[model samples]
Target: MDGLAGIVREAGRAGDRVGYFAALYRQVTVEVRTAVHGGLFDDGARMDRFDTHFGNRYFDAYDAWRRDQSGPRCWREAFGLLDDPDTIIVQHLILGVNAHINLDLAIAAARTSPGEAIHALRRDFLLINDILARVVVTMQDSVDALSPFMSLLDRVGARTDERILDFSVRQSREEAWYNAVLLAGQNEEEREATIQRLDIRAAVLARLIARPGSLVRPALELIRSTENDDVPAVINHLDNAMERSSAKQGTA
Candidate 1:
């Protein structure tokens, strides 16, 4: 988790938008680690391995993308948007979430518990959704601070926009679970094919997030127009907010 924090810090210092996701991800990892230490999971040891494997997926992809090497299509889509001026902070975040959850999460779960053992992982897997929910709420608060118009857009959109975002997360996680089951049952060759397909599907979702429908696009643009453009400051603010949120969660 410290390694992840370093990545976030470096990206923030560079004013890289990639740090947007990295900052939020580091917080989620912190929460997961805290849960592991508290013995919140059914198998703390397995979760340790699971979290490590899951994080490596993002780390490896980030490294590969930095080197201009080939990686999963989904991650490429997310990383490719780093310099895009039109995308808002939330778009960067959800793009990362789309790739990580929809593609990497399933593969990590399957690798952690192959075949029949995947069923046992289900309980712990569902538990992560709860963790994600909490972290996302905190993340939203941080983003709201940076993008004040976000709250106004939420109201003007009747919160339907927020609901749509929530629904996407829930649906993707459910699909990831089913995909993990399938991957666990497959042989090496078959698993590769399935993962390739998942990557394509996830990349498509990233595109949707980058370019939403007309109804939401105007509001998103308005929010983006009013957002703080200081990349480093935005990243640091998010990181600090998440740190405070994690501390509160730890105490609670």
Candidate 2:
């Protein structure tokens, strides 16, 4: 968690757009760690291992991307957009989420619980959705601060807009779970093939997130126009908001 936070801080200091996702990811890790400490999972030890494996995928990819080395196609798609001035902050975050959740998560789960043992991980795995929902709600508030017009876009688009903007975390995670089950049942050779397919699918999703569609693009552009363009300041604000949210959650 400290290492993840360090990455977020360093990215922020360097005015890197990657910090947008890293900040949100650090918050998710913090919440997952807190849940583990609170005995939220059926097997805390196993959950710890699962969390570590899941996070390492992102950490490894981030390290590789920074070095201009090849990585998962989905992650490469996300990282490639970091320098695009036209791409809004929300797009950056969603690109990261699409890659991480759609591809890395399934692989991590399969690695954590191979074979029939994957069934045992179902309950705890579902619990992560709850944690994500909570963290994302709070993170949305932080994003709202960064882009006040987001609310206007939300009201204008309603459910259709939300589906486009939010990218349906619940649905994505559920699909990831199904993919994990499939991967768990496969041998190494088969699993690699499945992973390649998933990577392509996830990369496609990243492109959709980055480009969305005509219906939402104009509204997104409006929001982007109004957003705080200071990359480091935006990252710091998001990081601090997550910290404050964690403190409140701790007290509660």
Candidate 3:
């Protein structure tokens, strides 16, 4: 079985997290289709609708969707297929990291001078746009996986409800940071705003894990293992959040 560290690195390669996410989006979508068409073990029929280059069919679909509909709704509907809790958590992190890439591209476009850098930024923006569309589709597939389990859980009483709540909180904070950076200038104000937005969630998660007799060390170690980058900091925060949630679970 793949561990979280491997998963994080796999999702962050080639200095282009968006590309990593695009690959993951396709993989997860295939997995969902396999699960839906046959059992989880069967090789499902594949759909190559969004399999074009970063700018061709993929970007076209993304532009049409952006013009025709809302942004977050598309993702909420996309990954809603996956029924497994661990997969859903993984999807959340994937989506969050992908969102960060889009925001990063937007910031670069907003700040740089017109030249080769501008051309590169434009190219990057289109790629990011395609990635966003793919992520939405992938997220919808995950939602499908979660649907069947949701009803059973509702009937079976609260099971890991706190963990779900914690995930939601972290997802929101990640989204907020993405928005702040994407919409604002690349100046100090923008950095401060994004860092502040992320800080709130980090503080909450730290407190949650710092409770009496919590399993904070392993998670902290995991966070520390992540290489020095923006992605690593976010992973560290989530690790802490998970640690806190686990501690709370143990006490309960």
Candidate 4:
């Protein structure tokens, strides 16, 4: 009912809890929508199609995974955690990112251009990454803004640590690109198998995020304890931060 947890929580109650990531994802589609209408990408039309097609796959999976209809292992693991009481906001974000980037992203890229056409897709592919990266940095800031403990978390270094920042999204994305390259050359059947393997591998990551060790668990608890819990406020702050970041880079 509340917008604080974003659309994801509402989806859970609706039996499609994947809405947890869907909320953030819906925000991404808006950003991509703007880019499409404004011709922000190199091959604007093609990228727009790619973005839309890619986003829809995730949305479909959200429903399927929710109902036990069928989906990737990584996504299943991520969705299963939506109602988890011990899961912190960052962990929820991480679970979504882990499934999307480590798993979904590679699949999207491969499916976008099978075989040699994949090479042609690379430039535009990275272009989309550029757009997402800027939003990501600001989303990082938004978390610190919406969550009380993030202020203290920010003091750890001259800057906030990357792990806590995007929860290693930056690092994971780099590997995703490499994995995508491999997927591009595979056949559909092979790609399907590969997806399952990646999902299995990604499931381990979701586990660590949800059930981290003692040292990390305490810090995760602090952030959850201090979180605002106002879903609309949190989403608004995140959207505003995304817009500001976009403007700074002239992407808006």
lDDT of 2 by residue, 64-112 (tens): 9988857999999899998999888778877888888999888888999
Off by over 4 Å in 2: 155-162, 246-252
User: TM-score for model 3?
Assistant: 0.27
Clashes in predicted model 2: 0
For every candidate in turn, the CA RMSD to the true structure comes to 2.2, 2.1, 16.9, 4.4
CA shift of 169, model 2, Å:
1.2
lDDT by residue (tens digit), candidate 1, 167-203: 3777888999999999999999999999999999998
Query: Each candidate: what lDDT?
Result: 0.86, 0.85, 0.36, 0.68
Compare candidates 1 and 2 on lDDT and give the better one. Answer: 1
lDDT of 4 by residue, 206-230 (tens): 7776777676667777788888665
TM-score of each: 0.93, 0.93, 0.27, 0.82
Report the Cα lDDT for candidate 2. Answer: 0.85
Tell me the spans in candidate 3 whose CA falls farther than 4 Å from its real position. 1-134, 142-186, 198-252
Model 4 segments more than 4 A misplaced: 1-20, 158-167, 232-236, 244-252
Considering every candidate listed, which one attains the maximal lDDT?
1
